[model samples]
Target: MTHDPTDQYLPRGEFSFLSLSIGAMIRVLYYRLRGMRPVRVGHCKQCGACCRNLHLFHRGKWIQTRRQFKRMIAECPEYERFEIMDDPGMLLLFSCRFLSEDNICQDYENRPSACLEYPTLDLHLRSKVLYPNCGYSFKMVKDFGKTMKAVAHIQEQAEDKEDADE
Candidate 1:
């Protein structure tokens, strides 16, 4: 079988809020059928993975690397003046520009809604893709609040094994 990667990421059918990406649709169906919801691990660990792995939504994908971001800015001239949300240190740290020396958000109280909803599944998203050291988990329930699956997800098993190997 042949594969066209572009066709994978591009959304088919009419583009609208109701329509979601294929990956997101799968996750949404899973959670809706199983009644899964965000279950944050008690207390913030301030690991800063969310910040370091900073993701920006653009062109039906997440802009992660700086080079990609620069290209995005080039393509969208209006974005050349994009708002700066992080602090200056982020340039050197390559984590979150908003993170303090101790890994706390410098503007925690005034952080954007996206920041406030760290790890929360968005409209088109449902997977519980947490950072490597994030203190968050997903609780899947059925039978009216009876917990079925409550797993505190850490790094991927492959990563754990890789670390063990080294």
Candidate 2:
């Protein structure tokens, strides 16, 4: 899914960077505090907040919902209705259809790749740019930060390998 810069809620330019940093910090804190807890933090309460709050991006692309999937014959269709919507730098909105009235996925096990990978702290941190009104935003932010650090470490290793090869 692609977001328009003209979107009312979309984040602009340098603000995205600041938002990513803040999200990462929040994610780190959440993990530190949520350790050993049976219940995961920043998770849906089965309230379907994500589904109810769904908004499509500028293009016809949107997140695939269970209902949408049911219309498709195969799990991976030739024309996927949804695309990973990013605003040049960060991911943005991808609404789901399978979301129940209670905000739970009716067919979670068979959900698409996008649904399976939701609330990824890194993606959330990168995309949300500014915190949405969701309760999980803070926790997602923290996770995103930790993930960013890990990604940076990985990138550094890749760069080191290239330098050595040179």
Candidate 3:
């Protein structure tokens, strides 16, 4: 049998330097092609947070607010129900009319692809955007070496400016 190269980096489902390192080019490519994988499975608590603040992909751009989205997709049959609401951040929240009071989706069988990919770590890891009391979580690894180098460069430039001032 041929040796599995990833077996060296990944032992018992654990992964390290899978990305971030040129050494694991194959692993990195594999992950990039497969997209991010969750460490543990997540079950939606039916908080309905995912139902709110819908961002529709219209004309290759994300339209944040519901009113604008409605105007954009007015001709579509599914665009009949929506709510114009205020959210905490710069994004305007739009509640789905199909969602029930207990956070259960009324149209679960016909849910959109965006709904299926809610709370995506890839999308919101840097933004820190997630609903309160979410049961979902994902494991992410940041490149420490690259991050530290950028930090050190910024610090060195700041120090150089300070020394010049003195």
Candidate 4:
């Protein structure tokens, strides 16, 4: 499903990043443990929607003003590649300078990590949405609800058996 542009902005801080990364790792581990692997689906449509509509964050908050974006650039010079596209009060949207008129990356090979990792499951988990019309999605190998329930039932039975033995 498409995420509303007005939804809460994702935080950008060391702690927030770490927590999200850890959570994503845990989620992957859980799936692996359950024998359910996640698979990436769909190919890029080259629509440039991702390049044109970006919700950037810095210092645990969404960059809401040009001043804040400027500060971010000062701190991370590489961020200068992004330009402010709009500020709808709540958040500032950005566009990459490398995105060309033909909806192509001018520097495809040298794109930023954010660009390379667009539509990642970690991002989806954090934002609960993806760019509208983007041709990418993720899905698990299989549903694990029944498996987890069965596991819990087996554990409960084992615990009961031990208690009876005691």
Q: TM-score of each candidate?
A: 0.46, 0.34, 0.49, 0.59
Instruction: Arrange candidates, best lDDT first.
Output: 4, 3, 1, 2
Q: RMSD to the native, candidate 3?
A: 14.6
All-Cα superposition RMSD per candidate: 18.3, 15.2, 14.6, 9.1
On the 0 to 100 scale, the lDDT of residue 31 in model 3 is 46
Give a tens-digit lDDT track for model 3, residues 62-151. 456656666665755464555656754455556688877766667765565456545433334324455665555555444455567779
Q: Clashes in model 3: which pairs?
A: none
lDDT of 4: 0.67
Q: Which candidate wins on lDDT?
A: 4
- Cα miss at 19, model 2 (Å)? 19
Give per-residue CA lDDT, model 2, range 1-166, as digits (tens). 1222243432211122232355555754555564411111343334455553433321223334544433442545622443333333223344455555655565554554444333434445445432354433332223445567779999999999999999
Q: Which parts of model 3 have CA positions greater than 4 angstroms off? A: 1-41, 65-68, 71-76, 87-90, 141-166
TM-score, model 1 to reference: 0.46
| Model 2 CA deviation exceeding 4 Å by range | 1-41, 53-75, 78-94, 128-166
Candidate 4, 66-154: lDDT as tens digits: 99989998997777889888878977889888777878677765565466556656666556666777776666776466678889999
Residue 96, candidate 3: Cα error in Å is 1.0
Instruction: Give the residue spans of candidate 4 off by over 4 A.
Output: 1-41, 120-128, 138-166
Please tell me which model should have the higher lDDT, number 1 or number 4.
Answer: 4
| Better lDDT candidate (3, 4) | 4
- For each candidate, the alpha-carbon lDDT, in order, equals 0.48, 0.42, 0.52, 0.67
- Candidate 2 clash total? 13
